[model samples]
Structures are given as structure tokens and as C-alpha cells.
Target: MKQFKVIGVAALALLLSATMAFAIGAGVGRDGTIVGTKGKAKTVQELIDMYDSTGCIDCHEDAHDDWAASPHARSIYGTGRAAATMITAMKNGFMSWEYSGVKSTKDIKVEHWMGCMKCHLPQLADATDEVAVELADTLNEWYANAKKALKNPDDKKAIAIRDKHQKTLTSLNINCLVCHNRMAITHKWTDGYPQHDTVYGFNDGEHEDETFTKMKRSLIMDESIFCGQCHGMGPNLELENPTQCATAYGSYMWAYRAEGGQESCQECHMEKSGLGHKILSYSDETMQKMAIDFKVESYVSQWLDGSTLKPKAVVKVKMVNRSGHSIPDG
Candidate 1:
């Protein structure tokens, strides 16, 4: 009993010490974490805790595990380089963004979570449930309330809650719900994303959605409009061919836009023939070696040869998986 009591006391002391150490936004991580605001948000560990606390773990426990092992999670968390730089900027007065001269590698200290859609969670717009309507109405109400507060800055009662709501930002991120959920393809005539699933298999026509009265969607896989939302190479998710690039989905089609193969962004980017959500970071080495064993396409006989005569035609069939993903290279 004496030893047990002593152990309990020791544990209690340690717990209290940790609790006391926490400041605003401070939390733990698999490695070092920064805490506090973007300026005061010190350590990389605290940022990781913020990311983990976004409630993504509840749905994507497995993908999160894989993410922890990926180079992305490591680079973001392990390298305190960005965190240190953010601190420097904070001291200089640029509070949130840790500006870096380096283009690709530069990331905000906690700049990601400023929005809800960045995380791979499903967009509420895609919801078929009344929950989206409820949430939207709530946000609208809150927005109105906050707007009123802005008018009367002196009102303390309305300021606090409205301030939190007004400043409520999420880390730009994604979870497996994004990758696993259905996605639409791009089109020249419409916006991308929230597009209809065309080339992507599963629901060839419709998309998988929950029952809802009114909900906004992120990757709505219903029509060409949705895929164009992101696969867009043009302004405002409007579909257009980027001059230097091939197809928006990384296809060899810029040169052949007139061809029927002038496919949309989701045609190549979204899952089809073993494509994953990570998008194409495939090296020639990965895209070079065939991963899949067999071809997964069907050819229409009517389109194959003239129907009039059974003329034996020499057909050159080459099925190459050029995209950096797992495809059955037959």
C-alpha cells in the first residue's frame, strides 16, 4: 500500500506538470511538437498534435498509420526546420505564415489547417444527408452573428464566441476519406471536382453519397463539373488545356486535344486501373516497371473494325501503364 501510494503520487505529479506545461494549441506528438499560436506555436510536435486532433483518426485509422510512415508525414513533422523559421518570422511580426525563399519546400508553420477541406475527409457538400443543411445553416447563423459583432466591437458578450467562430481555421489536410471516396473527372465545358465519375470505375454514373437534404461536396463524383474543380489547369476550376503540360491527368493529350482522348483530369488522376489518391509522383522507374498483371479494359467490336466484311486487319495493341501507380502491365 505504501509503495502503491508513492507511485500514484509520483504519477500525479508528472501528469500535473505536463498539464501545466501546455499553452494555447500546445500538444504532444510522435516526435517534437510546437505549441501555442502560429507565432507561439512552438515545436513540430504540437503541430502534429493539432493535425491528429482534427478528428481524422476516427475514420482513417489505417491510412493515418501509413501516412506516419510516408516521407510526407516525416518531412512535415521530423524536420523542425520549418518550425524554427516560423518562430523567426513570428518574432519579426509576420504572425502566421513562415515565409521561405525556397519555393517547393517552404510550408507555413501551421498554415495547412486553415481550412476544413484540405484534410482528406469527405466534403460536407457531398453529403446527401440533412446534416449538411443543418451545419450550413448553423454556419450561416454564426456568420451573421459574427458579422453583427464586427459592427459592435465593444460588445463583449457577442465578441468572444463570435471571435472564435470567425477565426475558426482548420489545417489544410486530407484523410483516406478523400482518396477512398468517389471522384469525378475534368471537362472542357465545366468546372472540375464535384464532377461526375466517368472514366473512374465503381459507380459508373452516380457517386457514393450519404442521404442528406442539402450538403456541399468536395470531390463530388457525379458529373464532369466536379473533376474539373481540381484537375483544372485553368482559372477558377474552369477546364482548359495547360500549354506546357499534357492532359491535366498527366496524359499525353495536349498534342491531341481534338481526339476523343482529350480526357478530363479525373480520367487519369482519380482511381482507375490501380491509381491511388497520392497523385502522380511516379518516377520513370516506377512507371517503367509494370505493376499490374493484366489489362482491365474492354474494346467495342463495332469500333474495332468495319462491320461490313470480316476483314482480317493487323492491329497493333500496346497496353502500357505509363502513370506512376500500380497497374496490371500486361
Candidate 2:
């Protein structure tokens, strides 16, 4: 994607940070394969392992590559900026007004931060009931496995055990099914454990699986409402007449709609301005180019200066808000 132009001499910078790296540890091998339970589980990590994205690439090779290069994959990876900020908070305590005075991660607990995880660390959001308990228990189990593996470094079983533990500690790799199957994925607490099921709605199209087709349409091809699920929520920071926090959708209804806008969010953000999956923000030079324009003009004085050239320079800046909601809303 190309960048929107700048008004003056400033060349747009395309130096945005790409992604943070997930700090790899014991248990998982060089191939990113986890030696963990392949089915239902008793802990949060176990549940997430059941839906890992490692295999999705085999079937969705192109999309997988596109997404791998996106900020979505990098966002929750241990190396991402958000991950670094959260890691700091996890270690140093809550640093915002929302969780004001919380002393540590243990003090407020991971489950209490559902609002953040629902977007950033969605696997944690997908797991059902007593999530904090599941997280705590899973962490302890992984630690134990790590210890066992360390004690017998050469043992194959020990290595597997260690890898299993490492899988739990690593943030859930951004899985494709989350966005595509958002309408279908269901998690419920059953018998004191969480169970996840995907029931897509299929249509009688050329494809046999109507639900899969519909899921793709709802998320990838047309709809913007799916993006709204997270982006439309409270805590929007772009409100012009500011309040504590408000939904971007509300502001869209108030201002953007009045401008006769009809395009979905994806039309601008994803399809036109981004790589297949590298959903960028306004700060990206490419994004800036798509949304703004500038023109410069100069005029010499009718009466020339006694000894020097005097001229008037005018710069015209045009910012076209094609989006239905305020940019930087999220």
C-alpha cells in the first residue's frame, strides 16, 4: 500500500514497527509444534492448544502468509508492542485509570482484564468460565513440566513435557478461525470445564459448506460489523466532544453517516489500503496517502522588493475521511 502525501517538505515516514517477537522458551521445538494434549483439556492452555493455528497454513497458505505479516499475528506475540506493554503491566502492576491502584497481575487477575484480551489475546476470551483459575492452574502445570524437562534434558518424554509447558506460556498464536468463525465458535462451561464448538452457518452456494462461505462473507468479503464488535465498543479515544469513553459506532452514526458515507470499514482499511491481512493504522505512510492530499502554490508580489525576491506561499491540505467512523477510534 502507498502512503497519502504530506503538505510541506516533510516526506512521509514509512518506518512503522512491524511486530514484536514472541520470546520462545522451553517445550516447543524450532518448528513451532507443541507437544501438548490434542483434544479437550482441564486448563486454559489445554483448551487453546486444542485450537492452535499451526496447521491452518497447510490449507490457507496464501492467507496464512498474508496474516503472518500482519499486525494481528504480531500484536499478541511476546515481541509485539502491546505485548511488551502488557508484560510490563503484568510485572509492575496496572498502569491505567481503568485498573487504577491494582498492585499486580495477581491483584486484579487475568480474567478481570477481559476487555483487553477480547481483542488482543482472543484465545483467552474464547475460553469459558472461571478463566483466571484455568490460567493459574495451567501456568503451574507448565512450570512443573519445565522443571521435569530441565532435570532430564536428553529424555524425549521430558522434552515433550517441556514443550507442552512452553505452549501454554506462549500467547495463543492468532488463529484464522477466530475471525472467520466468529459467528460459529461457541464456548460453554460444562461439568466445570470449558468446551469449544464451531458450528458455521452454511448456505446453498457453489461450495458445499454454506456456513463456511457465509462466515467468509461476513468477515472477509463484505461486512464491517464484525470489525465493529471490537472497534465499536466503549473506550474509543477519537471522540471530538469527548466523554470518558464511547463507542466509535455511535460517533459514526452522529458524524460520518451525515457525510453520505456508505463504504464498509474494510473497503478503506483492508482492501484498498492494506496487504491481505496487514491491517494498518492511519500512521502508516501507505494509509496516509489513501486518506489525504495536499497542494502548494506560490505567487510573486506585483511590486517586486527593492533588492530581493519576495513571494507568498500557500499550502492547501485536504484530508478526506472516507471512513464511516473517526480514524484512531480504537
Candidate 3:
């Protein structure tokens, strides 16, 4: 009996075709081993590398690049660390919240409010720079974080962190910029001898590199107002701390190189228009004996009650933001 002849020829042909298709699907092709037919494989890790702690290199590639290792940057962050510790003492309670991830304005807006930008970001009295607006947005974002903390300050976990941060704030680590932006011109802002007429400029700029250092800050090194941008408060205050630097200057232990090796805030926080971030530094012991120093002193008199003539007293003070930032004053 011929078994192959039992089924119809057409049916046999269909069965053979179906068998061939199943065999093709089940087995591997010439590519060796068969994997999922996704796309080509990636070479780099999706997320692995971390940012380097080498100062503001990417943003400040020029003169400030030189300054990245200087004490100015150190003081800038140091002041912040000291401030955080002070806030911890205040016992706002929410302690564990970490702000170390904040690396830029975007980070500040999205993460936490730092004491430096709260004031040092700069607000021009007679000018409005879009850069300032970017800075303002960043600070406002910080305000948003603070407001969030304040609203629910009663939360046990949040309260602990808040109180801890509050302790740092109360320690007077942040100083003027922690509260103010405006400074009085007081008098002639002259450096050396050749007096030039005063010209107002914005506190902010977007120059990726080599900006005001070549033009402005190089010239205005003597004016207290420049230093005031971070330490003075009145109309320019962005945030208020009861422990104001204006009230007690020695708390940060500032040392000055500007006025004969004296310690003051301006000596280190000095910004040349083109120079990038200035990181100031300090210590508590050195700051204790340091007193408020002024470059110029003035007095006011109105003929001792007679309306004949008048004069007002003014003074200039120079300080190193902290120890070892020995860059001198005019």
C-alpha cells in the first residue's frame, strides 16, 4: 500500500508549505544567535558621570577660571556652609533635606534657596539687566522653596529641617546679600588720583567670559557701594534675617586685605565686571577681633544751629571676606 498516495496531492502540498513556515519561525537565522529585533545597541551609559567640583569652570572660562581656585569662591561657598549650620541651630526642624544637588540657577529654581544668591545675585538701582531677571527668577524659585517650608512649618520632619536651616540663618553667616541689594553712593567714588565722573551700570551681565573685568570692575575697586551690593540693606533687601550682618559684622570672622591687612566683607567679595564668581572665605576666631573698617570718613555740621553752612560725615570700610583672601583694596 502506497501511503503517500492516500491524501490528495493539493492537500499534501498545503501541509508541506505550513510545515516549512513553522520551521522557519522556530529556528535561528544566520546572524548566529537571535535576540529581540529592537534598535542598535547604545555605547554610553544612560546616566553615570557626575559633575566635577572644580569651581565655575564651564560658565567662567577666562579670568574667573583663574579665580576658581582662589579664596573668593571658597568664601562664597564657605559663607553658605556657615549659614546652613546657623539655620540648623534655629531648630526649624526639617533637617535632612539636602541642597547639595543645586548646581545652577536652574537648580536653585527647582531645588533649594541658597543664602548667596538671595542677595549677591545683584539688583541694579538704575538698570534692569535680563541677566538680573534670570537671577531674580532663580532667587524667586528659592523664595518658592522657603514659602513652601514656611506654610507647613509645623510638619515634624519639615519643621526639623526648617529649624535646622533657621539656626544657620540666625548665625549671620550670609550677611548683607542675605538681606539687601542697595547701597548709598554717599560721595565721590574715586580710586587713586584721576577722578572720573560716576557712571551707573547694571549689577548683572551675561558675558560668557572677559566682560567687565576689562572694562568696569577693574576701575571701581574703591567704592563701598560695590561691596554694599552684598552687605548693605535698605531698599535692596531681598531677604530679611534678624541676625543681620549690618547689625553684627564680626560673626562671619571676616579678615580684610583691602585696608592694611584688615578684615572686612568687601576685600574678597569684590567683583570685577568681567571676572566670574568670586568665592570669599572666613573663620570665626579671626572675625572676632576684626572691626568695621572704612576707607573714607566724613562728618556733618550745620554751623552748630546757625543756618550758614552744612557738612555731613561719611566713612569707608574695607574688609577681607575671611582669612587668606589677601587681594588688597584701592
**Per-model C-alpha lDDT, please?**
0.34, 0.49, 0.33
**lDDT (tens digit, per residue) of candidate 2 on 1-330:** 133345222332322211111322222221221211132244565556555555556656887887776666654443434544444444443434454444533444445445455556655544544554455444445555656767877777866865664555454555565564432222212211111222132332233332222221222224555566555656634422222332666666567666777776677777877555667666578877775554455554444579866675555555666556766666
Candidate 3 matches the true fold with a TM-score of 0.26
Instruction: Supply candidate 2's per-residue lDDT for 16.
Output: 20
Q: Write the per-residue lDDT of candidate 1 for residues 42-145, one digit (tens) a residue.
A: 32233223334334455446646655443234221123343232233333332233442212223222222112222222232222223322333333444556
lDDT of 1 at 24: 22
lDDT-wise, the better of 1 and 2 is 2
The candidate maximizing lDDT is 2
Instruction: Assess candidate 2 and give its lDDT.
Output: 0.49
Worst 10 residues of 1 by lDDT: 30-39
lDDT of 3 by residue, 172-248 (tens): 22222211112222222332211111112334333333311211223333544445444444232343322233312
RMSD of 2: 20.0
What TM-score would candidate 2 get against the native? Answer: 0.55
Candidate 2's clash total is 16
Error of 1 at 286 (Å): 4.9
